[model samples]
Target: MPAALEESAKPVIIGRSSSHFTRVTRIFAAELHVDYSFRVVRDLMSSNPEDYGGNPALKIPSLQTPRGVWFGSLNVCRELWRRSSPRPRVVWPEDHDEPLLANAQELVLQAMSTEVSLIMGKLGGTGDSAHHTKMRQSLINMMAWLEDNATSVLAALPQPRDLSYLEVTLFCLVSHLEFRDVLPTAPYPELNKFCQQFAARASIGETTFGFDT
Candidate 1:
């Protein structure tokens, strides 16, 4: 490819606009100031890896960089941070030594994955199956625990941090539940409050989720 073509490539983010996992990377991109092109994954049901930026997992939010393609949201975010100059202080999951913070990170990711499964099942016309019902119950249980523990978990996190993956993922997950009508967020006041505060960030504002047309 020509030099101009290569520079014009920037970094291509392959994912759907409405996807929470995708939004996480998009927000990270905005925060890190990494200019990139957005390539929407038109069909989530497609089995073709090409549709998902050559992700063998057929997942979205993959980042295509000159260095290589990143497979998932966290990998993409880490690469973005690596490329960032005067990098911000990012608190990774390993930084959370305490049980509260570590557990919070784990549950937030679990909730996001559960949400994905539930949404995919719905889209696949399997929403009414027994497994789907169990998944919904699991999600509800997780949310309840999160609502009770959110404050303590946040308090345990390190102070004076620029960003933490846990916070970003939690914000995306809670806001997404309401966005997709998977569940009403009103019941989880603590999570709602956190979402309201997190939503004020410029990065979060820029990456508001919306289904691809």
Candidate 2:
């Protein structure tokens, strides 16, 4: 993308730099060649919907666009795709009709949400509660399942595609677990390998997760 055009079309992306969901949309924006201005949400616990770009759900990664406010990563990514002159071939969640592809997508998102809950609980000083303990165990179980199925799940994805939401989210989920120390990711070799490969992309490199200064 050229600098002049990028500046002219700069959409405002509201979210924390460290958020996996936010990173997903940022990656898509980069891939789609849609330059955006990032607005950092300093406090994750802020009750103001304005903090989340008019998202009533108060979630990060909401896109403030000329058309309107998009309230989720997927929606933001789709909108970005639509705005791109030459759209890349993208495989969305709805394209996963087979059980293997569909289940993998489901599990990846579930794990991401579960990680969010666990982290929120810890930050709220409820890390030692029984529910937290159960959530931890559930996370452990889900990781194990993902590790065991990683090979087959990835193999089942459509070939010759520019990108897939399944792969992007899986990469974010696995990498975020390691990044936040929600779990030790060393045991999931397949997922780790996948991340190693995916991390080489320019889109992924530009959006490396970190705290905003």
Candidate 3:
């Protein structure tokens, strides 16, 4: 994490600063003390694949690295973990063998994806469309489920661990809802409390969501 070392031959992280998926990988990189140069993808609606670092899926978070392009936040985060010396103990999605843990991970990811669809729909001027309405309901259902189960989910996470993908993704999802103004989260007291506690991390502060410019 030395200043000189951080500036040396860093990988390029291609994504918009406001993306939740992008923030997820950035948080992981920070936690692992991995340095990388950020390349802003200025246009989210760009049809060209090159606009998103040659991602065929046109996703925001594609990591251009020495090894090759790693598409998606999960792959990028895994690669970041692999590159870190003295790697910290991380609880990945695969480690959630129990029903409670597995369900939490599933709901968190699903909710994130749903939130993205809703945002895109609104930006595309389809906010009043039937599918958009369904997506809103889906997000509502998922949030209600997560909020009601937050206490048990937090208590169930494995202790003495450096970090868990579930927790990080959950934090990003909740925080992004507020950041993007996609949903009003005031009703979810449990989730709000969790976010309040998690926001104390330096990584969280460093990766605060905002427009690139």
C-alpha positional error of residue 111 in candidate 1 after TM-score superposition, expressed in Å:
0.9
lDDT of 3 by residue, 1-213 (tens): 665564355888999889999999999999999989999998888899998989999887998875678999899999888888889999999988799889988999999999999999988999999999999999999999999999999898887789889889999999999889999999999999999999999999899999978
Clashes of each: 0, 0, 0
List pairs with backbone clashes in candidate 3.
Answer: none
The candidate 1 region of ten consecutive residues with least summed lDDT is: 1-10
lDDT (Cα, tens digit) per residue for candidate 1, span 1-213: 876676446898999889999999898888888888999999888999999989999887899987679999999999888877779998888898888888888888888999999988998899999999999999999999899998888777788888889989999999999899898999999999998998899998899989789
**TM-score for each model:** 0.94, 0.94, 0.94
Compute the lDDT of residue 85 as modeled in candidate 2.
Answer: 68
lDDT of candidate 2 over 16-105, digit per residue (tens): 889999999999989888978999999999999999998999888898866679999899989888888698899999999988789888
lDDT, model 1:
0.89
Worst 10 residues of 2 by lDDT: 1-10
Question: What is the lDDT of every predicted structure here?
Answer: 0.89, 0.89, 0.91
The TM-score measured for candidate 1 stands at 0.94
Measured over all alpha carbons after superposition, the RMSD of each candidate to the real structure, in angstroms, is: 2.0, 3.2, 3.3
